[model samples]
Target: MSWLPNADIALLKKRAVIIQKMRRFFIQRDLLEVETPSLSQAGVTDQHLFCFKTHFVGPEISERKPDPLGVPLYLQTSPEFHMKRLLSAGSGSIFQIAKAFRNEESGRYHNPEFTLLEWYRVGFDHFQLMDEMEQLLKLVLACDNATRLTYQQAFQLHLDVDPLSASLEQLKVAGASLDLGDVLDNEDDKDTVLQLLFCVAIEPVIANDAPCFVYNFPASQAALARISKDDNRVAERFEVYYKGIELANGFHELSDSKEQRLRFEKDNRLRQKNNLPQMPIDHRFVDSLDSLPDCSGVALGIDRLIMLATGQSHIDNVVSFTIKGA
Candidate 1:
């Protein structure tokens, strides 16, 4: 029946065990577990992410006229901003398994509402974060080995192109060769084309066998990651993939407030160009960046991880219910 949960009883029990093991893994590392609000006054400006909007009404009814429309709020897409604020306020090494909301996202590997396991490790860069992430995956997937590749290397090995030096025309040609179909339009950005090509051509080849950590993405794709000192064209970012499924995204947190503000403004500009709603910038989060320690953080998809662990083909199989089922 439509009222039934998507997951069976045994699957739900296994899900609970996975969650428990995850908590124990973090607790053993002394990473304090904390909870942050799932709703906020402002939402992320990232052009690719969309936040669900809502209104918060006051409890008082007999009092003076409360704004009938109520105060506008947004459901958080990630707990990253709030957690970073806590880190700036001197809360070192924290982790959270929280509910994150994203508008217009649902598929075999995605859901509008999903559980995220996010954490920060002070004094750790992207490499260190990857090591810790690998350890966590080992415990969950019961795997001992993982492959490592840089963004450049993966592209080179899989697609026979240099991701950094390749021109837009070259990328378009590569995409055409792969039969990706109409990858180039006058309006398409370079990074967008690269991503399209990467997804179809490169991603599967890298992690098809074992869990793989692909690091050092192009600087343009870096959301909050610091640019690499060794190579200005790359950012200190890494993503974890298992069996052709992307499971985690991590960054060496950027601490420069000015740069952070510039990135947010740039995101809004892109949003405006794409005719998407420009989100209100989180000024508090920007201010917190000034004091944010040199740390690394990651957001891992709980459902996708469970899908991989249990050999489930669809995300709905691991979760209790999909949004429609719920």
Candidate 2:
């Protein structure tokens, strides 16, 4: 019936155990647990992400109280912006297991609303952060040491193509083998092509027996990560995969406010081209970057982790309710 939870009692208990293990892992490292507001005046600028918007109505005043329509607010896609504000305020090395919402499709591995385990490590590069991520995954999943690869290496191994240097023609040729049809025909974004190839051809074939970390992504796809000093063509971004499931995404954070603003503007431009609504940039977050320390941050999917830990097949099995159930 509608009154019952989507997940069983045993799966619910297992989820609790997994979260406890995660908290213990962070606490031992001296990372403070913090919380940020779930709703905010501004939303993320990433064109790929969609936010759930709402309006806050205050107590009834006169018929005219300036703008009486109330202020538009958005449910956060992640706690990244607010948590970075805490770091700018001198909170060293913090973590949060927060409820994140996204307006997106739901399936075996996704829910519109889910729990995310996100953390920031001061004085850590993406590599160092990967080291910590490896330790935590081993402890929580009881899995073996993870294998590491560069984004280029992964594309080379799986598709026999270089993601960074491949021309649109070359990418389309490779994508042809996957029967992607016109998916890449009219698409001009190189990063979009690489992502389709990676998702359709590579992610499914990643090492499934244990965790595999693919790092040094193409610079164009570097969401908030810094471009690598050793290689200008790549950014210090990484993703953790296990059993064909993308478990986490991490970045060596970019600290330049100007560059961040440019990226935000670029995303809005892209949104305009694609007929999507432009998202308001979180200026407070941009303002905090001057004091933002050199660090690495990662966001892990808790429902997927629980699915792996408990041997459940779908996200619905681990979460209390899915969108339909809700």
Candidate 3:
């Protein structure tokens, strides 16, 4: 068996250069660089995400009768909760290039442990954030001005269906042509079906050369984004796609503590319904939401950006080590 880094020297050098450039780009924009804890007492409750759990042993923890294993700590899937806490604490406009972990399938585009470039811009809405994202893409990838579309428009343009107003039956009918097999038939959740349709039918066919920004996702898929004031049916969320890869996800953040908690509970309920593991909600993070500033935040996949920058096809080609190599 061979033991070597997945990335060669040239690829490693290119990766370093890209990171340095990213730092410079953010620094010039006056966003403060900050670091948050990678391990937390609670994990994300999102049904779509899973956390890597580890045990924390204190000097006296092992002797406790109630628990045989030390306190369970979870490796954060994203630094979002911690960063938002910082924002709540009055840290204005911060950014982080940090390691994030997720327990999931790892392959061409995904790594269990990967670098993420996340930032929050105070007082900016989703549109303003999208504009800044375009500028950054121009600087880093040297791409042309991206075409913009609402989530509804993207679906209509590509699949000739109205995602925002479509009934569950209508969406299922639209998705039927994809021949996605039992996946579509078995899914009862409208949001799940819409997400699958977006991934399978739309993502591959989007602009392959320049970036594309799809905004105003359905409220059901809002996650942490605020629902649109003008239209309650959708949220102020946006996602950036470039070279047929999803590069960034951003939101005009929701600052309601109560609403946030309800969302978390909803996610756990969904997890229970699906027989997936229920994650402990980070109460500390939720509590901080009341003080969180009106801002926009986004998390960009650094490894994928590096892959696009260096003309690499697989994630492993841009990182020093793959999961197997590690």
Candidate 4:
């Protein structure tokens, strides 16, 4: 739209306008838009995240490929950890529109690369942030379908069980009866099992009549969110959904570096058990924990939001050029 030499005109215009709307929406709330470095001294440790590995030593290096003693560089999965660091550094409220990457994921709803709209707000807990998420969707789409449901409630209403308190034996039994859970078991991978159940059992039944937020996650699955005070059995996190598709994820961010480190360890252990590569910990980000405020943050998929706003279904429709086409 602005005479970009590389980007397509029509797609550029749409992306530009969408970004404009997003920035103005947040700006009205006095949230600061900021930038962050794409590369880091270390990489993400989340087992669910798969970073595209690379070598980034300067050209002056004697070794060209960064082999043998190469310094590992990677494409970021999300700007979340860095943005959280900013929160710790007294950045009261901030947002960043960043390009993120993940390896071996390509589908109608996914790409190897995509835009991530990550933001954080201090002084608000997870539910407060859920309210904020509703505001964002309402403002962005000019719609009021910010419905709320707990994970357990969603599961009970859809799958006829309480996910939080269900035993492994019970889950395996219950899951073996569902289309999504027939392959999952307590003897199998928990993440994969839960994900399979989610895909087949619960996620599809979300409020298609309106936008929805599913909250109160299991504590064992609490990626980086704190355990709920009302119920330590669950975490204070939520995922925003539209038309049965996941659009965003938010958390009452876990502030204790110790707890954060433990989660990272758990994730890596799972990854190792599954034969996935273990990533290095981001120490600088961990160091920022001392200065980080009590806050809640979210990362929303801009491509998916655009798809919903424009009534498109596939992510490639919103992307200017997809990995397959590129």
Candidate 5:
């Protein structure tokens, strides 16, 4: 029947076991488990992230005359803002395994709706968090070792170009050599070119024998991570990849209220430029920065992690249902 789940009944059982082990891993470390609302009035303004919008209807539409379409709500792309609010209110060291929603994300490693394992460490930086992440993965996936590389190092080793200083033209040439697709002559931005080349030319080469952590991304690509003090040109961010699949993203949290606001504004401007819908900035989250402790946080895709652990190739093989199946 078309209504049946995509994953076999046996695979579903294995997925449950993985989740159980993950919970135990965090519990032993004394990280408090918490939950936040999946819907919000405000959403992330990141240009690259798209939110699914919905409307609420009251029992009687005419009774509420001021707004007839009810409050426009967004299915949260991540639980980051609400979790950060809790951190601001002094809920130290929290974690959640929650459902997250996104728009325009689907395929081998993505789904419009998926489970996310997000956690925050009160006093840890990106490096310390990476260590914790490694431990968690090792325990859950039964892995022993992981490889580490800087963004520049990964580029140099794989694509043989200095990522930070490479001109747009150089990246275009590299992309052309890879034969991924046409690199239009009009494209001039460094970040855009670098990202395209990284995904096509470099990402596929990451070793599958061990997990990989690519750290210290260029400053421009940092979403919420703080700029590294050691190197102003790079952000204190890292991503985990297993078997050529990106499994998680971690950040040395940026706590500056002004900078956070500026970033949101910049994201909105980019959204406008690209003819994408601009989102409302989460001002409350920005306000909470004053109370948020020095911390590091990460969001991991539960489905992808399970896929890696279970030796599944397609993301749909591990999940009970995919969007199309549902």
Candidate 6:
């Protein structure tokens, strides 16, 4: 018998249909479909996300015939890093649907590996990208009226606090008062604290309703998005939520190489503080950043999108095969 439940075959067909429609949507818009290497020499400097590691062996490097230096590589958690590299090289607008992996994550909502749909729009701001995200969600669901909300508003409506402005102490207090789960060990880090609050307070509410976009994230938490000028306190970033599942993340691309370096260095510092191994910085990416166009980009989980579209609650239902069962 197939690992996937026979009933899910219908859902699988729907997933294929949506994926086909997505390619058509971008094609009609004149966006080029691109591919990037999955086995990369470096990793995202973000200290929180963990990636699965592998070793590359080749005779070319060490003349060992089959193996040399046991070259270390990682399964990409997202195609963002590589896709942005393309943008820096003047690829006007691009999109890709690819497989991504994350280590040490397994749950009803997570698998060690999953499908990712990512795209970039040149000469667009984050808000413009938000509008595009709405269109994409509507297209996938084949329905209109999907909801949208800012991060602050989502928190205020659900957690009763302004996440962007909340003090760490205030966040801790809020967490305790609400019987929210345990605080992150590094709650002093505002980004970490904000994430905790969002998970504890905002997530349940966002998940309970129709799909929504959590927009305008804190600047400190902006991994690769440009910081918002008006607020200086937040970055132009957003994540789409549906049926309690996070479906997509979008950013107004950060084009400054120096800033990107600063962020990468900061992330490395964080890794040292946490005793995690440091990853090599991708200098090629930094070089490209200098010439990178102003763009808005987003990544969607095709499987999760399928889950919502077909009303299948668990991620396993949409996947052809899952790690645990595989």
- C-alpha lDDT score of every prediction, in listed order: 0.90, 0.91, 0.91, 0.79, 0.88, 0.80
What tens digits encode model 4's per-residue C-alpha lDDT throughout 113-164?
9999998989989889888888888877777657888888887887777787
In lDDT terms, which candidate is top?
Answer: 3
lDDT of 2 by residue, 1-326 (tens): 78899999987987888899899999999999999999988898888899999877875432334344786789999999999999999999999999999998589998999999999999999999999999999988899999999999998888888888889889888878898888879889888888889999989888687799999998888888999999999999999999999999999999998899999999999999889999888898999998999999999999998899899899998989889988
- Alpha-carbon TM-score of each model against the true structure: 0.95, 0.96, 0.97, 0.90, 0.95, 0.91
Give the clash count for model 6.
1
Please identify which of the two predictions, 1 or 4, would achieve the higher lDDT against the true structure. Answer: 1
Candidate 2 ranges beyond 4 A from true positions: 59-68
Backbone clashes per model, in order? 0, 0, 0, 2, 0, 1
- lDDT by residue (1-326, candidate 5, tens digit) is 99999899998999999899999989999999999999987888987788998777645422224345776778999999999999999999999999999999999888899999999999999999999999999988888688899999999888778988888777676567776554645666678788777787767777478898999999998888999998988999999988788889999999999999998999889889889989988888999987889999999999999998888988999888899988
Which candidate ranks first by TM-score, i.e. highest? 3
Residue 91 shift from truth in candidate 3, angstroms: 0.9
lDDT of 5 at 99: 98
Candidate 1 lDDT score relative to the true structure: 0.90
Over the stretch 219-305, how does candidate 3's per-residue lDDT look in tens digits? 999999999999999999999998889999999999999999999999999999999999888898999999999999999999999
- The TM-score, computed over Cα atoms with residue i paired to residue i, of candidate 3 is 0.97
Q: Can you write out model 1's per-residue Cα lDDT over 91-144, one digit (the tens) per residue?
A: 999999999999999998999999999999999999999999988998899875
User: Runs in model 5 with CA error above 4 Å?
Assistant: 59-68, 183-186
* Residue 137 in candidate 4, Cα distance off native in Å: 0.8
Q: Model 3 residue 305 lDDT?
A: 90
Candidate order (lDDT)? 3, 2, 1, 5, 6, 4
Q: Local error of candidate 6 at 129, Å?
A: 1.3
Native-to-model Cα distance after best TM-score fit, residue 257 in candidate 2, in Å: 0.4
